[model samples]
Target chain A: MNLPRKEWAAALCALPASEVKHLANVLSGELEVRDVALPHAGLGLLNLRDGAFEESYFIGEIPVARAEVIVRSAGGMEERGGALIVDDRAQFARSIAILDAVMAGKLPGSVPAMTLVQRGMEVRQQKQIERKKLLTATRVDFSLLGQEDDEDEE
Target chain B: MSYVAIKGGKAAIDGAASASEYLRSKGSLDEPLTLAMIEEQLRLLTSRVVSEGGLYHPRLAALALKQFQGDTLEAAFALRAYRSTKPRLLESPVQDTANMRCIRRISSAFKEVPGGQYLGATYDYALRLLQLDLANEDPAAFKAVAKSFLRDTPETELPDNFPKVIDSLRAEGLLPPVAPSRAAAFDITRDPLVFPVPRSAALATMARAETGGLLAMAYSNMRGYGDVHPTVAELRVGYLPVMLPHPVTGELMEAGEVLVTECEVVAMYEGTNGDELPTFTLGYGACFGHNEVKAISMAILDRALQKGMQDGPTNPSEDPEFVLLHVDGVDSMGFASHYKMPHYVTFQSDMDRLRTTQQKMQQKESEATT
Candidate 1:
């Protein structure tokens, strides 16, 4: 399942210590996971899976946007970061965990704060889908292709 | 939502991620190392990173390795997924073999090429044993063995276009007439393969197919399946140029180079026409990265699948479904490894079926006894 960076990070960081330890164990089997500290960056880890790993960043006990996952291979390192977007329903289910945990008091932070963030992210995703629909709906305008100019002249 | 509610899925998933991280850390690395070290020190492995991962950047491969602490396959997967997102910078033109910068060149046809016979580095005549002497840093011994091989070599000018042996047969009317023009070849990368893929697509599918999967299928074919006798006509491994049209000038320009290995095989087949003459067809294979065995196997499989062949060959290569579907690393790796995820639901279903089957069998046995 493909999860957005923000949701993946939030899900990872907002876990209670028990859940964190659980994830740590699962990740450890196939990867050499490492934690790193940046001056302003929140807690994150270097996840080494399948002989390669990506750097994940988090903020304020919340997973933030713009977390770069760098993939290394034969030619070299490729850093990929983009909007916290998701395509698959399975991914959406996977991402809802941390927010759910926060809501259930299994994780830290004020309930309102976590709820607000969750709602905001969902709104952002909804807006993007609407924008896509709008663009697609209007994409067939002949004027945009410059054919309308000839019709007007005629 | 369905009647079945997924309880504690969030908690379970979160736990899984942490456990994964912990396991990866504990499993792989006992020492701390940076990406720079892997890139600089382990160049061979780094090359593997590119080829397997399908990413051409060594620096990135190194970083990924450092992050993963030498988990090569993981690094490769990460790279491959990332590679899909990157925009293509340019389209490379098909390179001609004549123009290849000969870092190493050899021919079975004559002793030497036009430039002169340079044995280059080849293991063909060698004893196939790993040289422990090379570990002792003996450059002199390396030169001595090379000189001995070239001693009786006939010096000759290399043909501008090396005549392929198959083409020679075509000229003599021994084989089917050479096409007036080279037919456009089908490639798997450009199109999804339907079953009964053409020779070109079949080769492409095999070329990048996972090594282990191909090896297994080839082994199956050799054990028994269909008629296949493979003789390697030629095998060449070297760098090939990546050229592209210059956006401004529109002239083809050299962009870079990638290493490749090509293997050609000849297999006997019944004539396509009504002549009833014994004939042979060609199997061709080429792949990114320097793996000749994979190429050779691919070539053998390619020729085996041609029409008008005897049915004794039982190899997996002779079966189009077996050969075409099982070679790609992506599908095989994903499907094979996905079994690691939770299968409780499937397992429960299996249990229910098993109990029912056993009850029915017992009832049949009791009825028979009565």
Candidate 2:
């Protein structure tokens, strides 16, 4: 639960490399950071259950990047923050982990990281709204088939 | 017969690849094809590559599409080849399709369902007439087009939840309940697929099988080779969120989402066990990206194969071995293309047999004449 969920983690991961790198660049100068786990991009086989037998099988591997880092604050407080996103960049993973650590420990730049999250979430929500609008526009009205009554059923 | 290995023209072979690339690139000098364009313009083609490629990386799929000069089979081959280099990190927790954020959903069997039938972004009803304007399309025009559509679109909330059509059938006791397997489902990548595969393994193979190949097998049954005439219960296309256990917390959380197409089909039920009552049998199909035809074909074939397994196959489509063995495009392409390889040794051996047989026949004829 401490880690960012799918919604915002996607945005964090999708941040332009220059922007994420800029933030991580600044943070590295301030905080004593060390990789608890080396940042690396890898593959994860997505397991899916069948509609027939509920039997699970590997559908395919999604490109992913994950990193874990221990952030040390000036007060000698330490927090381990992890970042995992659906991306294929190791550098992005490390940068996002730094952002995650800052936000988790509420470090100096926590406000800025939170700012990015809000901005990205809004962008995502706007796209979703537009998509939902299109969905509303295209919903099937089956009244032509003498099912005028059923349109109101749902 | 053993192939005679011949070596030479290494430079020419490499030059041939470059020449092919030049031919593909020649027409477009000022404007070059981008990965985004390939992914967007060739949506279905890219989806096929992702599905058949057995990988979910769209950027890489686009690259493969571009690199292979839009040869889907080669693109898929490139992806599978790329996957061999990366380390397998983790196996995701099982995902439920019921949680899909569907962009398009329809049920052929029912007129209405829990969620209203959404007819989103399909060319099914559109005319096949050429739109010549696309040849000189302005990329920036999307802003105007999207804005105009948005202005007309009435605001309505997208229902996050969509109940499965099969769920209602099972509740009504019209369909058999699916019990979870006691053992782990088969992983085809790690294990060799032997005959008499489990349902999971069969589904996995069909999921990644080539679109044309799977269609051909399914079409055989539809054209009266087999008896499994199915009505699609539901077909959905959407972004299915993948859940992975948090590495640190060990709690399940959504990792990411991938575009997928899923189909559930209902077929004629027959009494199999003496004690059990007949219920409508189910066939399920799903794949990495939005290939509706592939999904439906896979579903039909799944039902057919299950029928073949349960009661014994009467036709090729019903036979699991026949369907699975022949539906892979890469495998078929490789085997078929290998015919162009040096077959001189075999041809010579055949020629020698024919000459000897002809000489014997000639001597017998000469003796008879004399």
**Using DockQ as the measure, which candidate wins?**
2
* Per-residue alpha-carbon lDDT of candidate 2 for residues B150-214, written as tens digits (9 for 90 to 100): 88888786687588988888988888877888677777778988989988888888889999999
* lDDT per residue as tens, model 1, B216-277: 66665556654556655555554544343322224443333445555566656555557556
User: Model 2 off-target regions past 4 Å?
Assistant: A1-8, A147-154, B138-143
Point to the candidate with the largest TM-score.
Answer: 2
DockQ-based class of model 2: medium
Worst 10 residues of 1 chain A by lDDT: A51-60
Q: Which stretches of model 1 miss by more than 4 angstroms?
A: A1-154, B1-76, B88-91, B105-119, B122-191, B220-227, B269-279, B308-315, B356-370
lDDT of 1 by residue, A50-87 (tens): 00001111000111111112122223322221112111
Q: Over the stretch A17-114, how does candidate 2's per-residue lDDT look in tens digits?
A: 67877887788788889998898988888889887768897777788888888888777867666767677887787887787777877887777777
- How much DockQ does model 2 earn? 0.62
Q: Write down the TM-score for model 1.
A: 0.53
TM-score of each: 0.53, 0.94
